[model samples]
Target: MSASSQSEPRLLFISGSSREKSFNKKLAKLGENIADANGIKGTFADLGDYPMPIYNGDIEVNDGPPDNARKLKALMEVHTGIFIASPEYNASFSPLLKNAIDWVSHIKDGGLQVYRTRVFALGAASPGGMGGLRGLAQLRLVLENGLNALVLPDQFVVPKAMEAFDDNGHLKNKENQETFKAVIQKLARAAHVLHG
Candidate 1:
């Protein structure tokens, strides 16, 4: 898919893990490709590039938000749609992702509430049979209840994600690819309906 030339991107995708070969990141790449193919501008938000210390009230009070947190929060506000590809940690999503959410939520009152009206979608990729499906539920609760956001009911969970993608990170199975494309479409349409 070609690059989106829009001055401001309408949608953003992020993988919740920071691992080098994170399966969730591979899944998020599929969402990006699908969005661009469908003429939707998708921005891939890398948590690794936006590193900050774990949230501590003392630190936040002393130093204010870290530079990376501020940068990430800024990026988040520009998008009307959000799609998250998360990896399961224990029975929930990653602490890295949770912290990022906390940081961004703090910035909501600083400007237009980022999570209030935007549309959100979720997915997960795992090597296990459940494919991180359990974590997606918790993630959904945090987005909808904790942040007061709107989330789509349908979600994708790619089991055996270790074997799901090729070397170039594209889903090798034709059906899986199509489903991922559908997820992107749903997010884009929801964003248009809510934020257009």
Candidate 2:
């Protein structure tokens, strides 16, 4: 990769839901911690911190994206990989998550760099048996085809997530925890290679 095209060695974690006690949010943080343990620098992205109105092309033509979109784009520019923990809503990812992507997708002049330059890993945590895997399926398709992102093949799912974590947000089951950590480690390794 050319020097200018290579981003810094960092990973980004984003939770599809913005709820304070959301299991998906906790999963994203856990991914970050696991990435750190695996010797990779990481950052957790909060959608709450980057609020914007529902997407509208008229608004974009009139005023461009909200300030938060620019801020999010800047963050994406620094990280070479992304981890997304999506919440299930109506058999798909939450509207909040989709809206965020829609707004960011409107960016031009290298705005789509995040999708093409970085590798993305999709995961989910849900109280249901399906573990939000159904929702993740839609997300992967949208990110890969709609946005043209390079999503990782391996995905992590936390089923019955409400009962899966402890007070510290760590998964109680040893096997599940190990699986989650393994996913993070793989993402770090892939990011390292792609950034070269």
Candidate 3:
């Protein structure tokens, strides 16, 4: 890469649910820890911190995006890669996550740089057998098709999430831990190649 394009890749972790003890949140935290252990810089962001009204075109025209939307968009812009730990709502991703994406997409930019330029990885934690994989499929579709973002083909999923982590908040199963690390490392490598 040229000197101007050779920048350190940073990963941002976002949890879809805002509950204090959310399983998805724990998964995101574990992702950060794994990324750190592997020498990748990652930041964990709580979506609750960036609150915005439900998306509506009328609201957008009347007041523009809420301040929180702009802040979240800016945050996404800085990171070269993003990992979203989404909770399954029915068969889809959580409303909170969908809303955040909707608001960010309406930022009035000529190009959807935040969504288009970043490499995204999707993961989920659930007590159910599928580990929210169904929801993750939907999320990947949105990121890749709706927003024209480049997303990794592999994803980490934690099933029986309540029992997936140990006391120290690391994955309890060794295989699961390795799987998670592989996915995260792949994202880091891809981000560096694309953005560095």
lDDT values of the candidates? 0.83, 0.86, 0.88
Model 1 spans with C-alpha error above 4 angstroms: 1-9
Please provide, for model 3 over 1-196, each residue's C-alpha lDDT reduced to its tens digit, 9 standing for 90 to 100: 2221436778889999999999999999899998888888888989999999999999999999889988888777777889999999898999999999999888887227778788899999999989999999899998888999999999989989989889898988999899989999999888888876
User: Clash totals for all models, in order?
Assistant: 0, 0, 0
How should the candidates be ordered by lDDT, best one leading?
3, 2, 1
- Best-to-worst order by TM-score is 3, 2, 1
What is the Cα root-mean-square deviation between model 1 and the actual structure?
3.5
lDDT of 2 by residue, 131-166 (tens): 999999999999999989999999999999979998
lDDT of 1 by residue, 55-112 (tens): 9988888888788887876777677788999999998999999998897777535523
Q: Over the full model, what C-alpha lDDT does candidate 3 score relative to the true structure?
A: 0.88
Candidate 1's TM-score reads: 0.92
Which run of 10 residues does model 1 get worst, by summed lDDT? Answer: 1-10
Runs in model 2 lying further than 4 Å from the true structure: 1-8
Candidate 3: worst-modelled 10 consecutive residues by lDDT: 1-10
